[model samples]
Target: MAGFFDRFRKPEPEPVRAELDQAGYEEVLDLIRADHKVPAVKRIRELTGLGLVQAKDLADAIEEGRWAPFPAPGQSLADRVRALLSQDRATDAVRMVAQETGMTEDEASRFIDGLDQP
Candidate 1:
């Protein structure tokens, strides 16, 4: 059986085409499936010709498994680190998120804060 990390790993891409070309769809899917909301939303807008609001909704849906946000952000990643104080882990989490998503420290902090909370 897969662990939490494996569970969140994206399903294999099957070459389905969408509003965007296959490459574009795949790119959007890659970011969305990774749960990189901001960039995924921006990429969705570029690929799907969606407005900002639409893109956000779409990206959120992708995260939620609608396309899901089921596990909550960083919940799985932070699971092992939860032994530390939330504040302590917050710093580590920020670093981890920044490395994974290419967000700055401040941006990663905000996102990690959301995940760090119960």
Candidate 2:
């Protein structure tokens, strides 16, 4: 009799946590860098099936460096910094230079600042 009663109970929906593959992650990063965060969050929700709040949190995490994009193979650090600078991500460019080349933050800032000088 108890077994029969159990059949009427609805199963609870499980929360899904999805991890983005390289391509998806890269796309999200590009969207975020382009200042299209709404689209980025929408993409995240599509890819991960997360709710709006969760998707927004994920996008924020990516922006805050809780996640990192894969580096392009064979790309030099200088080239990468220039690319970031071109995207108006100067702070991120400076951090990348400092991290990869063991330069002080001040040195990295100066290096990035000098990249466009004649």
Candidate 3:
């Protein structure tokens, strides 16, 4: 089963590790810190200007305790979607869901629509 899934999966991206100035390092640290509200990928992009896969790989490494990014960026995907929807940003929510889950627009729409069910 693992082999089967691996065949379909995108090859893992190589990790990113950028040297940063104190202020720059601290900024990413704050973003990945236990209580920070900024998204990990966003912070990585801000610091290193890496593309999404690289940024996410770096963020994952930081999250695994290599860089004290432990408590993880204070928000979960569901919460983010809810936040966007609460702000009347359904389109943004759909776009975000599609990007994160690799779903088609129709599938992401249906997924978001599920959140509205009681």
Candidate 4:
């Protein structure tokens, strides 16, 4: 004597969402996956004393082409001077070009100096 009322309930499907940005942690993870020859993340963290998140962010920026990785802070002034010494007339030394380009010597030095360093 049961009633005909208990046989057709269906479950709802979960909503789909877009991929979330990796921030930095995920980006470092991606880079590690790409190149595992060296423990780069570990070394970088040790040298910079940056937190896991910051380190990862920097790594991500480098990988994404949003930032460049060169001209480490401890580089010598001689190297900087050498780079300025090597430029052609169009791209001469930072101080020399700064006068014509209307850019600050410090700014030009940093850019050209960085290129001079390894």
Candidate 5:
């Protein structure tokens, strides 16, 4: 009579650490903002002049903020996006805010979309 307890138990896998250079990280961010259509990996290559694999590694590090930005003042998205695309992802930005603030994605998207409207 075997009980509900299972015989197999495994430990959780460790997180993988990426070896990233600080200068490369900052350059990737700049490229992403500059060329809106470029995917994360390509932006990394163009900016750092690194090969594909190295570029991707750098981009991943930046997204996780392994090398995050220092607090600073700069241009607004409205201006930046206007230069890039006619319509920007206001909803996506709102969702990101919601995720940080512990609000539901739907609620955050609604809130931001409303703000954008007249």
Candidate 6:
């Protein structure tokens, strides 16, 4: 009976391809050196064609001196929440988000709800 229900669970999202090209490497590094995270993310997205989350991850990695493009999948908080939700652990997911982000319970609930959409 449990096996029957397992077939209907949502699959985890595919990991983002966040490889940075050499063309804009210097410019992106300069932005990071200047402590301009948002602009660095935008520039990374432009160069690598990654999504906002992926670009941000790449930028963070670069800043940390760990610029390897590939890492464990679903490394972001949103991805962790999504993983928990997929496993039918909504309460745990909400609690984890609230604790990690210092969000109120209501805000955390809304944040989890927002993740339900595409």
C-alpha TM-score for every candidate: 0.35, 0.50, 0.38, 0.29, 0.33, 0.41
User: Which regions of candidate 4 are displaced past 4 Å?
Assistant: 1-34, 69-118
Any residue pairs clashing in model 4, and if so which?
none
Worst 10 residues of 4 by lDDT: 14-23
Candidate 6, residues 9-107, lDDT tens digits: the string is 997665545556544665786798798989998888877778788788878766654453322464888887786688776866676677678898799
Quote the RMSD, in angstroms, for model 4.
14.9
Q: How many clashes (backbone atoms < 3 Å, residues ≥3 apart in a chain or on different chains) does model 3 have?
A: 0
Against the true structure, candidate 1 reaches a TM-score of 0.35
Q: By the TM-score metric, which is better: model 4 or model 5?
A: 5
Task: For residues 38-93, write the lDDT of model 5, one tens digit per residue.
Answer: 47677555554667666666566555434443222584533432322334545435
RMSD of candidates 1 onward, in order: 16.4, 5.7, 14.3, 14.9, 11.9, 18.0
Candidate 1 global lDDT: 0.59
Stretches > 4 Å off in candidate 5: 1-40, 48-54, 57-88, 114-118
* Candidate 5 steric clashes: 0
| Per-candidate local distance difference test | 0.59, 0.81, 0.65, 0.49, 0.51, 0.73
Poorest 10 consecutive residues by lDDT, candidate 6: 65-74
Q: Which stretches of candidate 2 lie over 4 Å from their true place?
A: 1-11, 14-17, 69-118
Clashing pairs in 1: 63-68, 63-69, 64-68, 64-69, 65-68
Over 4 Å off, model 1:
1-18, 67-118
Best by lDDT: 2
lDDT of 4: 0.49
Give the per-residue Cα lDDT of candidate 6 at 65. Answer: 47
Q: Is candidate 1 or candidate 4 better by TM-score?
A: 1
Residue 24 accuracy (lDDT) in model 4: 37
> What would the per-residue lDDT of candidate 3 be over residues 23-50, giving only the tens digit for each residue?
5645665576665634857876766668
Q: Write the per-residue lDDT of candidate 4 for residues 1-118, one digit (tens) a residue.
A: 1344434545454332322232333444455557841354554465556556665666655444344323438855456346547544223355444544466767866766566344
Q: Model 2, 34: alpha-carbon shift in Å?
A: 1.1
